[model samples]
Target: MKFKRYASSFLLQIALAFFILSCGNSAEKKAAEESNTETTSVETKQKTILFFGNSLTAGYGIDQDDSFAGLTQARIDSLGMDYKVINGGLSGETTAGGLSRLDWFLEDEPSIFVLELGGNDGLRGIQLSETKSNLLAIIDKVRAKYPNTKIILAGMQIPPNMGQEYTEEFKAIYPDVAKEKNVTLIPFLLEGVAGMPELNLPDGIHPTEAGHKIVLETIWPYIQAKL
Candidate 1:
């Protein structure tokens, strides 16, 4: 009888240990699952701010981080805003090129879409009508894919190297598109930064680091209000 009792006691201890280990594993698994869920939720909460433009938006002469779009991202992060900025700018990109490749970026719906093309078209002396048509088509595509995406057209202007007639017409393209589409229009993207030698690189086409900072300020008001 004593032997039987000792053996039974030993078996009971073994069962107890197994039970404790099973509970510990279950608890750890539950905690890990909860953590993963929380992380996914945070990621989904962030809305996207798409900056679709050309070399000016690409930060041609300076570190991309110094671009206006980059600054906007930094500001959003610092404020803990639930928004992310996607820089879709391509160097030497014209409105036609932008429209062709827009579908790629539209895969993910953006909360705000800042259109900043046409400067290249103006510089190249592309017909103003063609430039305007391309801009409209691009906006239409965005609207079709994501109707709720807030569109903000960044107005652009080129030097009289294209002639005063072309220059003025180019400048009017943005507002015209914005008005027709009934979207937000940034009066002048490079308002304070343009024509300032210190703000631009030797090319005078792209803004320098300081210039991008100024550009950031110009658009912050519009972005802040949307956010």
Candidate 2:
């Protein structure tokens, strides 16, 4: 009886030790998996450059991939950049509309912000002061959200039908904003593509695929400098 009791006690001790060791191994494995997951999340988080604008930035009638922003993304990939380009464009979006939604996009905390709005405001003949105010507000909001973020303002122009005075005023808005905000400026977003029938689509407003290539060329230098 004494021998049997001693044998039973020894077996129980062995079982308890095995159980404790198994639990320790499981906890260690779980901790390793969690650490790996956290490392992957940090490694995959890329810095972002946000392009915010109207249909011109949205690629209008063309495929989204053909837009200047998309082409810019391809260029970034080709150059093996660690930045992600986000096209935050919408068709027929006005300065006011952009102003209202600017906060939403800013939530992502972009490293660089390309402001391309106000074209629709110009086309619609909205007051230049109002346009300027909205744009200034956007810049202020972006600065508030990301104080160190680099900002690029794309200049836009209205057609002569809007009258030479209005057109000139519209053309001056971008450079003026860039000066006041102390931001970089792309002299004219549509420069070579604007007046050329071959470069524009049927609407003569948005750029065709070929035109977007030109647009890319115009802005690439400025963007490269920023990057």
Candidate 3:
């Protein structure tokens, strides 16, 4: 009887040990699975779309939320696209200024970069050659950093006050750059918004909130095409 009891007790102990080890293995597997799931979630968050430009892009003279960039983001979100739009615009930013800071923005590795500069340069009556050179350099740096990034050049026009010759050349810069770089071109960023008294603010330079909506419409087609 004593021997039998000892054998039974040993078997029970062995069975308990096996059950404990099995539970531990299951717990470890569950933990590893959760960790993998968390990693995947982080990896699949969203891609970035960067808008690099001047006051027009920065939504100068209006609420930032009412800017074209913000409106565009709202539209994108409504469509459930996995993209995050970043407004890298600065008020009164010239092409030279943009070029100087382009390297810092390139670090973000945006999937799409919308170039909207040179308007300020034109307004300031900066030399057309210098403006074009700065813009070209900016594009080159962007290409070097993100080879596969899609570039959208937003064309801008200045008032004819700077002389018809300067105006024409300044206006041509965008299309020329787009053609040369083989990037997508937004023919005219302020196409419908420009010269419309109702669309513009008192300054007649920056667009009003209503104007930004039109701006969004102007660029939406190009942006959609890339997606």
Candidate 4:
């Protein structure tokens, strides 16, 4: 009888150990499933936006925190939308530079693209046709990769110092590109903010924090409808 009792006790301990192990495994599997569900939910909720531009878009000479892209993201979040705005702004980047990086930027498959280039090209007096060609390539590439992605072209102005003929050509580039590509255009990104001294940065080129606000207001209507 003593031997039988000892044997029974040993079997009971083994059974208890097996039960604990099974519970742990089950719990782990359930947790993993929950984690995967959460990930999927977050992904579905978020939309990806790629911002490709020059100094203005890069928030040149401004704190990274106060850059236009940062402000736009903050506004997006405040509106309670799930979206990711990727900054691909390269300071001093011309149209050619923007085109060169197009392939790499498209790898992430952005749902929307904000093209704010050509300013540097204008500043440097790059050939108009060359600038247009580079922009065309980028537009084509984006359309091919993500056909549904919304494209917003931010237009720029040439300093009167660059000959009136050159200035007119530069000014025309934005609209022509937009029209040819059939994409939305933000004609004169600076709009009300550009010439306003109070809204501009110390450099007299980049926009101040207040300038960024004005920008948002300018672009908000069109962007809102798309969003």
The lDDT of model 4 is 0.86
- Whole-model alpha-carbon lDDT for candidate 3: 0.92
Please give the RMSD to the true structure for each candidate, in Å: 3.8, 1.9, 2.8, 3.7
TM-score of every prediction relative to native: 0.82, 0.90, 0.86, 0.81
* Best model number under TM-score: 2
- lDDT to native, each model: 0.92, 0.93, 0.92, 0.86
| Total residue pair clashes for candidate 4 | 0
Single out the weakest 10-residue window by summed lDDT for candidate 3.
100-109
Candidate 4 segments exceeding 4 Å error = 1-45
For 12-46, candidate 1 gives per-residue lDDT tens digits of 99999999999999999999999999999978787
User: What clash count does candidate 1 reach?
Assistant: 0
Cα lDDT of model 4 by residue, 95-169, tens digit: 998888788888767777988888888888889999999888889989988899999888889787789999999
Question: What TM-score number comes out for model 2?
Answer: 0.90
User: Which regions in candidate 1 have their CA more than 4 angstroms from the true location?
Assistant: 1-43
Clashing pairs in 1: none
Model 2: per-residue Cα lDDT over 129-151, one tens digit each: 99999999999999987899999
Q: Which parts of model 3 are misplaced by more than 4 Å? A: 1-31
Best to worst by TM-score, what's the order?
Answer: 2, 3, 1, 4
Q: Write the per-residue lDDT of candidate 3 for residues 1-227, one digit (tens) a residue.
A: 99999999999999999999999999999999999999998899788889999889999998888999999899999999999999999998999999988888877688899999998898889999999999889899999988999999999888998999999999999889999999999989999889999999998889999999999999999999987
